[model samples]
Target: MRVLIWKDGENHLIFNMLPGSGPDYNSVVELSLGQALIAGGGFSSWTYRSGFDVSLPVYSPMAAQLDSQQIAVQDRPWVVISSQINIHPEYTQELAHLAQEHSELLVLEACPSMQSSNYSMRCRGDEVYHYPQVLKRAKFCLVIRGARLGQPSLMDAMAAGCIPVMCADSLVMPFEDVIDWKRAAIFILEENLNSLMEVLSSVSDEHVSEMQVQGSWLYQSYFSSINAVTQTTLEILNDRVFAQRARTFEDWNLPPNPLAARSPLFLQLTAPRSQGFTAVILTYDRVESLFLLIQKLAKVPSLNKILIVWNNQRKSPPHSSMIPKIDKPLKIIKTTANKLSNRFYPYEEIETEAILTIDDDILMLTADELEFGYEVWREFPDRIVGFPSRTHVWDNVTMHWKYESEWTNQISMVLTGAAFHHKYWSYLYTTAMPGNIKEWVDQHMNCEDIAMNFLVANVTQKAPIKVTPRKKFKCPECTNTEMLSADLNHMMERSQCIDRFSAIYGYMPLQTVEFRADPVLYKDTFPEKLKRFNDIGSL
Candidate 1:
């Protein structure tokens, strides 16, 4: 009785039934298997039942009325239940009693439909005070199914960036197969309604924030409009028929899977790891420091080629004859504009898969340290591996991503000022980075390192690696007033970049790790000759 009717097959199978009188009973049973977005739980008949596997749930399209579509981060402190008092009277009474017992925890819901007998009464109007506004205020929304199978509240809660607690056990949610709801929602059995408060209490504010972000992203991507919902349903069906073509879980989630950057089935190492890496140095006007950096990098045994990204458009780089001759073949790329992003442009000359993105002024790193970082990169080809590191901490008080520079054991990003990443990332940086991050970095003439880190972490869902010890990576010798951090406002601008990048991504994609890679004999008592990386800056 179950078969794909609209499906194309080389076998060309056909079915015949008694000439249609609104489709014969047995024939109709067979046709139920056709691809369709059926509403009202298609068929109660024993012979012709369609389940979640064969049909998509069709909820009446409804949206929350908000003044603006902008999704701003907010602190939510209470667990809210929004069901009509008549919908589930007994459960409502139990919830009301629970709220009364733990006043601060249950907090607000004083509007007419959700008003409890003992709870304080406060409302702008009879409703949940614009309904969506109440959801925005709540940390978790208790989603218990109403008299019907589908409810509009679940979508509404997610649309407002409120994490939904799915208390409705057997109800099939929209796009259940394609969307990993566990990432955005919590599931609780209806029989366990009494323990609702206990469950909601256990979730921390950080976790609550992440779930809300995920929920909002899911709503906007797949369920924002009726057309979008319909398209998602069809795409799910198409993926089922052509399983190989289906997007991976990471693609659907849009970043690192927390398991691995590439996931269950990924290539071991795709970067040009076997060959030595190309040294890409960006410079503006620091002629002496630029030549000194080039001379130092040229001595590294693992270096393949040297590309001087001469960002100083006003003056062409010291002529080829004037350029210092080195052991490695050197090429100077004179750019059209003085953009920080120019260093990441995927040029035709880049033949290798791994690129070493370092700045002209960074001269503290030793040759041994560069080799060690390249070796680490070979093992983790898809990650950003380098010397300098930075962390992005969520500032609850400011409600934004705070750029933390104080050294800690943890690292979320490795600055490109002296980092090695796969050349493939250059393609993504110029073409596929999520938002206006490239343009932003170029326009401001700042935070290009942060923007590059965000793009890599966003795609890899993995934290960059920090090798060797790092104090400050500034020049041991001269000072330049033209440097990006010459003013008091430079630090503040970097902090704002983190917040802006996260906003464009729709969620925070940066991952932090307490992991650091050091040379095997880095801190050994053995003689200087015993250590391969003896010149690495003090641990």
Candidate 2:
């Protein structure tokens, strides 16, 4: 690959690309131009002396034609650095020493005079044409910051499919919001120059390969030419506006689905047996909290059955002695495994049409909220309905998740403190659970909530509805609890879930404008609120 710098007037500048003529003419870079000057010129006098004047016509059509040419990637293994000016003399000297110590490394110093111990002088006359050849055989290209932030050398390295080693600590790459620089490039602080070789060697071959591929893809997608960059920038701005508007509930005009009439699922169970919903509580070592939660449920007349899933890895006696007689029927199921996914085990025994999954520590959740969630679930029986909803948007450029508040109709995920119909549970059991549940449990991924939301959207052709709570519920016991380190492994798994859904369904699982109805309020039944006692034995 060859970079042709064209100076237009005294300010404007343009760049063009040309195919390599021969092995000797591997890469061409010209820096003594207006663009470099406007970007805080740091070029030395030697750079101007080495600059070549091309008689080729300088016009927009010709430049566009050249930029459209395919970038040629070479199988290179050496690390190449070609700079006429020494912006950081100390770092340059160390690089020269490194080249001498490593056979696979090459350094081309084009200063006024060679000041290093074993540095080779810049190639003279036509020998300089072999610059591209040296770059072609290099696996990594060193792009040190000069006088400014935006450096063309970084783009040059990416164009040749060479992994860029950025040495500017404060430099922010172009299109950063849309592109994750860490995945495509390596960044080292200027102060870390002494250990540059060690740092380079630490990167595994697989990681290097992935970076190279991602760098090439990024260049083609966003940095191929000035026009391409401009178009991508506009698209990014538009996307941000679209996301913000969606979150603010602006221009949300989707008609309510008349087909979303309440299903007979909940009414059928509660009509004869007064068992509208089954409440599943997941507990682990928090026996006191579990007993308090059960007591709260016993006060609600709407609750039909309660299932307490005791998940204590240690063999401990059941705490059934704390149970107090109430109108609602109660059952306890104990498991030796501490799998967080055990919250879903009650699906098989859920005689009620709808199920409400709640954490054992949520003490302030009133019976009204559960009943409201049940009403919302009835309208969208195929969709998961819950409180505490979150919307996630995937940034293609950065390869990261962007979260937002649950909008009118679109919800990316919902917390387990929600209600869903039994049919949705069966859908997950049949589609995503057969062969994958064990691996998920073994990973200690506490993202079963996130996974269930994704699966619900995948199975149902609609986004989940997040019911807004009339009043906030407080979980005093859960306020300061820290999750285990093993539970922090959800990011990778969530990304995988998004990838799988996109691959199978041909689009991302981002929910857009959907209708959200106001939560129905029910009168409180118990005049005296049940509170958690300090001692578990006292209960």
Candidate 3:
């Protein structure tokens, strides 16, 4: 990427892109590069240049065009703003009469070419000055898209709270991603120049104000500082990588019969051709939170089956617990304290389109939230999965969890254990769980989920962590208590235990790995956090 700094002399900065990394990181790298350019005497001589005037910070051609006396004074109260500078002989008389009849804002027609008594004049094109300054002084800008599409002009106009009366089809528009255009700018078709007067007249101050707010919001959301482009770039440079992989449930010997006769579970629960996914929660003693999770998970629109793999708890059944038994088949798999059963049994039982491995202590999540996740997973299957962080509330906290959308370009390493693709679990099962139980069991420690993620990261050289958009969840048991006290203590303990165990034997087989130590928090304080807490008190 080449950046040209326009000062008294032109300074060029050439940036070389690294192999394997694409334009995704360009925005982030530019921040550092811009600082370097500034520090290298790039703007040293620019302080006292020819056209420098600090007081006249904002330069609006509209203001200049509207305040000059180059057009004929008009009788009507309305003002007609035009982009044309050349006052041709044919239209000069009409323009003068119109100005004489109403307020007219005309572009400067160079010397005595077309003089009028009733108008204000301003020059167009290059003499208008830079965008940031120009936009601040103008009520509205006549945007000729030839300047730059999706460039800083439109953004600046929006930022400065100026209304942009622009041509519909321009050289460049920031229509690259998604934007609600009606809420942003007033787009005029060149062919509809006759109606332009009417359009301008119809625009109310209130409408303009609303549009300004909407435009500003859009700009800040997608184009401002600390945006997705910036975040994604930072992730790449920081050695955090995210990738999405897709596979049919059939590929993993899971359910949702693409072939009709295969799954009894699907046949009983869903309509023919109805797509579904199962979430098999792996749990032990956290019964209260587990029941809460079941209630939340029940709200997910696409969930076909809910299976609770109760490690070494044959005495408990799904009906006896706080979790209700719905029309969908809910089962509790009881097993002895065999380490392998805790790790593998849930995966084995979740024979559906996709198997979401949730911890027992989650008590956050409604049907709509899960549906959002499913939709995101469908759209960006290559990017794995997404969910909002369940850590903190937005009102009390300063920053938000940035990853709660159907699509987000922002990348973070903090949400690995919360939500992920079912394919990832399968990958771990195949690659990391190939050996006998004794070989990998030592790999299991406190916070096995996080440890597994680290294991996957080491093996794959890609970050297994990400932020889920707005959906937040935490342990339900943590309510009315300091989050960092008992809740954080349990979490930290498990994490430290995992670290200690990994330090000892290095790697072990899946069967011997103990997943019981992984502490699942059960709160849904944040929208992204789906609180799935089992009724521990009842159990």
Candidate 4:
């Protein structure tokens, strides 16, 4: 194995390790650079302490240049250990012992001091240029802690597509929140130093192959350059801004009820079954599911009206007989726009205090669930309340939201069912849609539910609440075909929608919302005392 070292400042000198220099020892070089303090001591600068310190800053450009000269894994050495001056001598002794015990392992130990038992005497001036080549040929690179963490070796190993064996216990890996280091690197405790060979031997060839692949991915995603650090810093700043805004909202102490609650007859007018709340269902060709949903909703005595927005492209409407004959008023409104984006079109005509949006395919939502959701909306009328909520934003890699099962107050989006106050709906309806909404809808990327969630959260200065139901509701059509397909184009469009929302609002919607446990429902149904105010005849 050969090691390359470059000294950048005065003489642009390069150092190289010669082959057969010794039996069990390699050549390691050290180069020092200057340090400085900048920006009123907020950030302190440091000098290059290791060969990797100088190499990593230019790793991408240099690696690209060396990519064409890549060597197969079978051609590389069994192991490579480039030790710095600060590495404890005990670690060196262990390496020497391991090399002698396993001569077939072909360990290459490089150090500035050539003091080991099997010391390599030759050191060429151009080894720095071949560092990438050396790394490409090695199966594993030893990463040991020195003055600070062994980040340079870890990073260099990854950049060269070598599996890193990290011997630093306290070292903090970058972007731990997003990157799973265990999958990409081997971590060995100090106490396990004697068993180092055993540990390496225990790893299956398949696992090593996986680690090599993941190490390369990890380097490109995070350790390649300063971009990862900048992204992480920006994320922290975004969180701080969100926290400040949340604190401001906490201080305001706005009443839970919307402005409409101040009316003298507000209690009677907004009571369940008094036409206080309207159930809005959006349908697109699923007439059977639509009829079933209407039937279930009609059984709930508290609902005053059920408005079905027919968004199917078919020219002919379903026969009136297909619609369930329910006691509550059922009005089917036809729309020229067949897109799901038109789900909010009925918001303009809603005179009720609040509106409940349900999907046409929801099969098992009970009357108690609707009443429970309605009660939650009344208490937090400033927020959009819903079930089947997701707390995390969609991961671009996995294309799935994190923490999907748990209910969160700071929900990014809610699915299937959502309840909103009429005043809030009016605000959204009045707000002009983004100029690109048409294009978004045409591309099948228009998410009315997520858009509404963002709107309510932005306007109300509060995160939307996911109202937990007394009994879980089931939907046969829960997993849509487009979602199941996971088409890259569709995913890109969804990301674009979120980006557009953030660009227009001056803040990312996902960061602004706060996350908390699901709000508790005090009672399963609307209180019996409020039934006297019901103007519609009971079921």
Candidate 5:
């Protein structure tokens, strides 16, 4: 809707301007001009005329070009920008020189005549579309001031899954009330422009990865589309008007699942898993293997308590004469039913926050492996840390969740059959999980581990961590089927469980990660005395 006018020598043209400058208009789109209907924000501040809360700032969603291709988190050493000389000439010029020195720092030029450096380049005309792709590879996108107050690069960088480093003299971020941008973006004052490199360099790799994920999450949750933006604005207004029915800060920020809980870092950090872990072994008449497992577990230095869930109503409890005489205390609680779901029943005897939910037949795991896995779990208390890992893939032909037990680099689940998980999960599995999921596990007498994996990942929005190598949790001296995990029907049943569980939850929450935790000096050319977990079994 743009028209070009050719100037005549002595003629004057009359120009008439109207609000919105379109077919029909009812209100002005200016934030500063109106007393009543001025709700327009230039991509940042939402200044309500009759605002209910003065503390929370509302953001009018601004539309930006979106590139929907998702990429995994890669190795990044980036401090990037797309700068215009006309807007911030001094800043861009200084940044260009800085980029020449640090190969990691990149500066893209908006001015056509600007020359390309080893790390900096100019994007002209149609090349602007590729900006998001450039951002996708970067760890941080530098946001300098534009011609206006707020810049579009902030939104663009976030959409590209790049953390935005705000570098304006005075900057106010969008949706400051609801979205926690501080968790995602790094803010820098204009006076400390020279310290930008030092500040960015100080940020750890783990923190950078977290910020990138958070930035992308914030964008997708609030500003991906026009519909999302419009709806969010309306929701904000609704919340303001009806204060009694308003949601909490977590409700606005996090994905739906245990929104009230604090971050696991603060909550579980002080919980003394070091006082030792309580081993909860679920058994069904496998007395021989169960005793062997209990004997091995009794040797663990961190063994505090052992509770054997004797899930066999048809059979009588083994005589105390058959039980292994171990140093650690062992109590067998006979369950009312022989359900697989009995493994996760929260009992009063379990006193530790760290729970080793290992199967009775899993005797292949060494004491060193178990202790090392426990140490790893202490670091990531919210995740499932264990040996045997399983992955879920989408089958286009079948159009359902397909479970794969192959040895791949990536995995979505760490089977609780031999994993170390938080005791909090037992409570969640028994009560908080989706509709009739536990009952299904009971009826099938399988997939209780799968159900537990879902509940933990859903609560944390994080992937389960796989530790050391895998023996597929193979039990050499098992009287029963190998926990049904190695069987074809069991794999298929687990896959069906994933689909059914996803339907109940209304979304897939299991995150897939390409990683496995090994001890720091594991398998390296170090002295035998130096290596702690030397007995860690890996295939």
Candidate 6:
């Protein structure tokens, strides 16, 4: 009858009786099956018959002249090996003598080998032999179970209190966790056989005692055949379930199996992009210019913000309703005539690289000319420059704006009545004068823009301001133009209003700055701000 018992679900694979006991009954019949199963992913299982008559095993301690408790030497030591190792008879005799000389132990297993006639069991002195009896008394068992058939002998040695010393290169026997290999086993690789004597000579008595305690622990824990069978079963079954679940989940979540699937695009256009310039149209009751400037600014690409500072006490602006769609921030500052400067001045608080200062009286710059002004500032960051009037149609050649330079020479202050790059207030704050020229403009004059040009040029080392052609339609305020033409007296009065500042600062020019490579390089250029617009195009 054949009996197959599985202990732990799928781990321990053991087989009991073979067929009829004939001449074909080989001692290694079940061993061959165990080997095949081990090679095919299964744990080892040995079988012993329940009712077979067994010889009584003897475990008597061998008689010796030396004390068993005390090691042969103090620090010097030795190892015990079974007689199964392949060594010549003459070499074995030599091994015995050397062990005695070094005070090392050579506790040999007293079994006669079934093969190989080269070595005999005969040895030197009082043969300090290791039989089954000696094994129970010994502290260590050096097991080298390399052959297919001799593992049972090694286990038998382990059952007797002798700690087995198998090489690390050998297959891990079952119940390995129970053995404290680090303490009890002295593992040597096959390649280091030539130096085995040196290893044996270095073993100590304390080391041997530690090994004995560890060996006893291993016997109680791992070497039990029943426990080994139970542990192996769980390992095989858990591995199979985990692999199956992993494959099933991965298949469910895998992306659309179509060969040409496209990935979603995640492009972001978050930042505010501009040609990076701003236009501010200044107004005082003249909503026409404000409307016209907004219309033209709307068409200018890359304008960041448009601001309309309307100096009208009686009215609020209809800017959002009147202007075309633009992708820049729009704001309006409206105030009475008396609070004109105060209300509009706060808009200057808007932080930017440059500011466009516009005059309500005249308009000449076109949409194209306004953008070109920004390009000029970006390119030539060192000096202030204004747009030039377009086609001589809006030209102000008849108007002469004269002022004196620092050296007292008369220079024209006239620029095309359009736009100018604004300067940072910090430049004025750090100045020896301690204020933007505008602060003093309302005090001593109405020409705040003109005074600022002089202050910037003076402090910045005579950098010339360049004027470009304006694209907006240039027109003068009717009230101011009529007054100037009607009376030389009124014209002189307005001119005298700015004369006090001129006397204090020197002959001020309308155009004191020249275009440097880039006005921004002057290090004090403010950002251009555009807050609001109107539908009227350029006025």
Instruction: Report the error of model 2 at residue 497, Å.
Output: 4.9
**What's each prediction's TM-score?**
0.52, 0.42, 0.34, 0.42, 0.55, 0.35
lDDT of 1 by residue, 1-539 (tens): 22454453322322221211322222133443344433222222232223334223333233536332434434554565453223456666766777678654442344665436522233433433445555666777777755543456676677777788877666655666567888899888888877877887798777877887788788878777766666766676677667777777777776334566552214444434457889999898788998899889988888999998988868878888777889877888999999999999887778777799999988988899999899888888788899888898988999888988888988898899999988888988899877788888899988988888888777768789998886588775666565666565888999999999989988888889999899998788899888888787873
Angstrom error at residue 440, model 4: 2.3
lDDT of 3 by residue, 1-539 (tens): 13344343233232222211232312122433332311110111222121111101011223322221111112222133333333234444443554444443333233332254322333443443332333445455455332112223344455555566665353223322123466667877755644555676687766765665555555544334324334423332233122232222233222233433221121222222245667777776666677777777887767878877787444565555466756676877776653432543335556654555676665554465555555444443322343432121122353321112222333322233345354445546445643332244434423444344444433433432332234345565756363322455555454344434344436421111111111134232443344343221211
lDDT of 5 at 346: 81
Q: Who is ahead in TM-score, 2 or 6? A: 2
Error of 5 at 126 (Å): 41
lDDT of each: 0.71, 0.56, 0.42, 0.55, 0.71, 0.43
Report the poorest 10 consecutive residues by lDDT, candidate 1: 14-23
Models, CA RMSD each? 12.4, 19.8, 21.8, 18.3, 17.1, 28.3
Per-residue lDDT of model 4, residues 1-539, tens digit only? 11123222332323221211223221222224223111010010232222122222112333433342334456666654443334667876776677778753433444444555322231222232234446676777777755444334555577777787877665444444235677877889876776777888788777877777767765665446556534433443344447543323222222234432232223332344445578888776777777888888886666878888887766556888777798877777888767665666645566777778887766665665566667666666656666656554656786544333344445566553545444545445435555554446545735565566666656555666655432244455555552322455655555566666666667655533554333243333666555432222111
* Model 3 misplaced regions, further than 4 Å: 1-274, 318-323, 338-346, 380-417, 430-445, 455-460, 464-472, 477-539
Global Cα lDDT for candidate 2:
0.56
Candidate 5 minimal-lDDT segment of 10 residues: 9-18
State the lDDT of candidate 5 residue by residue for 212-260, as single tens digits: 7777777787767656665666677678768877877887776644454
Clash pairs, model 5 backbone: none
- Preferred candidate (lDDT higher): 1 or 4: 1
